[model samples]
Target: MSLRCLIVDDSARFLEAARTLLERDGVPVVGVASSGAEALSRAAELVPDVVLVDLDLDGESGLDVAAELARCVSSVIILISTHSLEDFQELVAASPARGFVHKSALSARAIRGVLGENGTGSAP
Candidate 1:
């Protein structure tokens, strides 16, 4: 089954880029939110299979959203951020996130790997 995805980023350009990339790779992006508050609301409404979140949001941090998602939904939260791997690792270790992804190198393959998908090449 295709993995239902949600993108939470404050930048419109970044959001569009991510949406295009994921959709091209066959991942269904069900919802997009520009802020942590919006993410929280939409996440509950959509309950996507995976949530791709930006570390720096407009009003709140993605880490906060990750924690909230853990309590509010069953979706796996993957943090996509511009932060360095070391910083991302520290944040991920503290938060209840499934993984950390560098926005600069985000790809369908990498996403699939994080999700533990096999060689099917099909969306999880």
Candidate 2:
């Protein structure tokens, strides 16, 4: 089954670009949110198969959002950022999110590789 994605990023520019890119790459983007509240609401409404949250959500941690999303949905949660993975390796390991995907390398293939077929998360 294909993953129906939701993107959560505080940047409007990044949101548009990411939605466009994911769609072009054949990942159906179900929704986009720019805030923690919005992301929660959209996830409840869309029940997407995957959610990609930016590491910096205008000062709020994306890992926080990922935790909440993981609590309620079976969807795969991926942390995406311009930051290096090593920078957030510990946090990512501790998070309930399935995996991390750099924003520059965001793609359906990358996401799939991280999630695998079951989409079970990686927790520290």
Candidate 1 lDDT over residue span 1-124, tens digit each: 3588999999999989999998997888999999877888999999899899888898788899889888988888889888887966876878888788899878777777788877475655
**What's the CA error at residue 36 for candidate 2, in Å?**
0.8
Q: TM-score winner among the candidates? A: 2
Estimate TM-scores for all models.
0.90, 0.91
lDDT of 2 by residue, 14-114 (tens): 99999999899788999999988899999999999889999899978899999988888888889999999999999999998888999999987788888
Model 2: lDDT equals 0.89
Output candidate 1 Cα RMSD: 2.6
What is the lDDT for 64 in model 1?
90
List, in order, the clash count of every candidate structure.
Answer: 1, 0
Candidate 1 — worst ten consecutive residues by lDDT sum? 115-124
Clashes of 1: 1
